[model samples]
Each structure stands twice: as structure tokens, then as C-alpha cells.
Target: MTYSGVVKVGGPADVHELTDLMISKVAVGPMHNNAYLLRCRATDEQLLIDAASEPRTLLNLIGESGVASVVTTHQHADHWGALAEIVDATGARTYAGRLDAEGIPVPTDVLVDDGDTITVGRVELTARHLVGHTPGSIALVYDDPHGHPHVFTGDCLFPGGVGNTHDDPEAFARLIDDVETKLFAQLPDETWVYPGHGNDTSLGAERPQLPEWRRRGW
Candidate 1:
């Protein structure tokens, strides 16, 4: 089946295949958090993003290959609901943003920073730290060699706008600025966005609304 990037809490995951990677996206937990299982085609090594919830389902998705690493996009509870359990089960190395590492209950094996490279087999994902939603919200960028770029934006970005800032103007400003400079400006229009919750979108689809989002201050 074609990859739609649409998933529900209890539905089956949507898998996207690329030349060197296979991205399986599933929605889990009450919050409808999206967890991504990335498998490297070359080495068969795997990595998971967000381990958000439902350890059993995640483990099943992981299968016998297991995962080499689990990256928490941010320190939010809903985002890492199953982090400890998943980590315990797979013995996967835990990675979190340097600033939000302390907020996560599990000890982080790797503290990622902006521009840091994380590898799964032969595939490399670049971390882009976007501050605002959380002091250390990181977005993982995978630039596909054969196609467009793919971004896993925890809660910092979404389809319509950036993540909520609890009405804090300063926080919203920082988030919008970081998203524009670090993401929109840097990436191409075809960049596919995989958010923490809800459906996926592209930078091109959202580029036109940047000014409106800033003006609305969300």
C-alpha cells in the first residue's frame, strides 16, 4: 500500500519506503501520539522515534531485529510515555535533547544537540533543536538520497502552525523563529513533516501560513 502518513490510536501503522530506509508510523496512547519505527535497509538495524506509548504494540512492531536507539523528541510526558518500558525491553540506547534530558525520567545515553548526527546502520539523521514548545524540543531530519527530506517534529510544529506555547508570547516567538530559520528556510518545499500528534504535512503546504501563524501568536 501507498504510505499516507495517517494513523489512529488503534489502527495499523502506515509504512513509507525509501531507497535506504523504511519508516513505519503508528499512533498510540490517548493523546494520539505518533511513534515512528525506522529500519535501515542496508544493515537491517532499527531506530525508534518517540516510543510514545503502548509498549506491547511498539515491541511487536520492533520484532526480532530490536532497535539500536530510541530518541525522545522532547521531554513531554505524552511524548515519552513508554520510554522507560521500551528502553528496558529492548536495551536500546536512549537519546534526548541536551536541555530536556533531565526532564526525562530515564537516564539518557546520548545528549543530542542541534546539528548532531545520529546513525542507524548506514542512515544518518540530523538533529535540529527548535526551542519554545520545550526548552529542548529537537526535530530529526532525514534527507533521503533519492527523494525529499523527512522531518520528525515532536511538538514544536504541526500542520496548521507551531505547537502551543500556553499563550506565552516570548515562547511562541522563539518557536516560530527557530522553525522558520532552522526548518523552513533551510529545508526544501517537499520536506515531509511527521509530527508528534495528528496527520502529516509538508513545509511547502505550510510555508504560506508562516506570517499568519506569527501574527496569530500560536
Candidate 2:
């Protein structure tokens, strides 16, 4: 949770062009958790990811970004504690993966499964199921302005550190394998990985760790 940075989600620079889509991450709450705001530059539409453990802070971002949806990466409290705040702020539909969908603490507007596509203006989010951190954990992929793929990996993967898999030791092992086989292996080497709570890193940076992950697999 110590790492932090902001990639301009909507514009090339301060211009906030509203042309290419934007993806920004914010660290909030007592847990210093990571949440994301994704806005389509062309449409000025926005979505919030993992609204965990903070209302005021989350609402402030929602107000600032004009988000239209609140999506969950998992059901853990640190990942979804701010659901109520995000929903109230944007009147945005809320979504969660099937396993964790019912665990969102409130009713969800959409139940997302693997291979689902969520459209927000010009941006389309493809949900990929990577179950290891939890029974239901998913990540998102979308095309960036550079034509490179980007992922909003919430608690699923971090810069170099992984999430709290020890809580469910066996599941954590599978999570690591899933990352190497399903995530790191498939995404472009240069694909940008926006972790749930740390500085961004490219897939190339994470690729080398796959063998170690395989060894550590449960």
C-alpha cells in the first residue's frame, strides 16, 4: 500500500483531452487501499473500481471524474467497503464477479462472469477470471491510446508483491499460477499493469517471476 502514482486517464497531459480513455488509481481508507477511476476521454464517461473502505474520499473522486459505474475486483472489505459511497455519488450501476457478486454488501445491478464486456462510452472492458486470491477474482483489460493493452488488477496482482493469499493459502497458490498462465502469459509484454495498491509495472517486469510463482503455487 505504500506505492502510488497517477496515470492521466483522459488526456495526454494536463489538457485532459477527453479523446483517449483515462484510467487513474487512488489509494484511500484506513487500509490505504487502491481504487481506480476509469474515464473514456472520447465520451467523458467514468467507472470506479474496488471502492474500498472510504466514502468521503471515494465520493470526491467520483464527483471529480463523473463516474457512471462501480465495479468490484473481489468481495473483501478492503476492496468493497466504499460501495455505498460510490453508488450514491454516481448513481452508477454496480457490478461484481459471480462468486463475489452476492458479497458486495448490497444489491448489484450487474452480475459479471468471465468473458463479459462492459462498455462505457468509447471504452470496452473485458473481464478475465483469475481465481486464486479468492473464489471469485477478476481483472479488466482495455485498449489504451497507445494501442497497448492495460489491466486494472485489484488485489489480484501487485507491482512485485502479491495480495494476502496466506489467508487462504491454497487459493493463493492457484492465484499465482493463474497470473502466470492466464494473465502474464497472455497480455502483451508491454501491457501496463495497474495494480490494486502500488506503482504500475509492465508485464515484462512481472514475466520473470512466473517461474517463482509456479514454484510457490499451492
Candidate 3:
């Protein structure tokens, strides 16, 4: 089937195959958190993003080819509900943003900052540290050589607007600024965005709404 990037809890994952990489996206847990299992076609090595919840389902999705690394996008409880469990089961190296590493219960093996590289075999994903959403929320960028860029935005971004700042103007401003400068300004409109929860969207689909989102103060 074609990769639509639409996944639901208790449903099958949506797989997107690139030239040298395979991305499988699934929704797990009560919050319907999205977890991505990335496998390198060349070396067969795998990396998982956001072990949110439902360890059993995640383990089942992993199958025999265990993951080599697990990256928690942020320190939010909903994002790492299955981090320690998945880590213990697969013995995968843990990675988190340096500023939010302390908040995650599982000891982060690698504390990442902006511009850090995480490899899945031959594929390299660049980390973009987006502050405001939990201080250390990060978005992973995979610039496909053959195609367009793909970004995994935890809770920092979604289709309509940036993540909730709980009416805090400063936090919202910081998030929008980082998202605009680091993501929107740097990447092209074709960039695919995989969020922490719910369905996916593209930069082009959201670009026109920047002014509206800012004005609404959400």
C-alpha cells in the first residue's frame, strides 16, 4: 500500500519506503502517540523514534530485527511511556535532548543538541533543537537525497499550529520562532512532517497559516 502517514491505535502501521530507508509509523497508547520504526535498507540496522506506549505492540512491530537506537523527542510523559521498557527489552541505545535528558527516567545514553547526527545505517538524520515545548523538544530531519526532506516533530508542531503553550505568550513565541527559523525557513515546502500524535502534514500545507497562527496566539 502507499504510505499515507495515517495511523491509528490498534491498527496496522503505515510504511514509507525510501531509496535506502524504510519508515514504519504506528500509533500506540491512550494518547494515540505515534512511534516510528526506521530501518536502513543497506545495513538492515534500525532506529526507533518515540517508544511512547504499548510495549507489546511495539515489540511485535520490531519483530526479530531489534532496534539499535531509540530517540525520545522530548521529556513529556506521554512521549516516553514505553522508553524504559523498550530500552530494557531491546537494549537499544537511548538518545534525548541534552536539556530534557534529566526529565526522562531512562538514563539517556546520548544527550543530543541541535545539529547532532543520528544514523540508521547509511541514512543520517539531523537533529533540530526546537525550544519552548518542554525546553528541549527536538525535531529530527532526514533530507532524502533522491526525494524531499522528512521531519519527525514530536509535540512542537502539528498541522494547524505549534504545540500548546498553555496560554503562555513567551513560550508560544519561542516555539513559533524556532519552528519558523529552524524548520519552515530552512526546509522546503515538500518536507513531510511526522508529528507525535495524529496524522501527518507537509510544510507547504502549513506555511500559509503562519500569520494566522501567530495572530490567534495559540
- lDDT by residue (28-120, candidate 3, tens digit) is 979999999999999999999999999999999898989999999999999899988899999999999999999999999999999999999
Kindly indicate the candidate among 2 and 3 with the higher lDDT: 3
Whichever of 1 and 2 has more TM-score, that candidate is 1
**Can you give the TM-score per candidate against the true fold?**
0.99, 0.85, 0.99
Error of 3 at 23 (Å): 0.5
Q: After superposition, how far is residue 141 of candidate 1 from its true place, in Å?
A: 0.4
Estimate the lDDT of model 1.
0.95
Please give the RMSD to the true structure for each candidate, in Å.
0.6, 4.6, 0.6
* Residue 199 error, candidate 3, Å: 0.5
The reply for model 1, stretches above 4 Å from the true place, is none
> How many clashes (backbone atoms < 3 Å, residues ≥3 apart in a chain or on different chains) does model 1 have?
0
Tell me the TM-score of model 2.
Answer: 0.85
How close to the true structure is residue 91 of candidate 3, measured as C-alpha lDDT?
97
Tens-place lDDT per residue, model 1, 1-218, is: 88999898889999999999999999998899999999999999999999888999899999998999999999999988898999998899999999999999999999999999999999999999999999999999999989999999999999999998999999999999999999999999999999999999999999999999988889
Q: Which regions of candidate 3 are displaced past 4 Å?
A: none
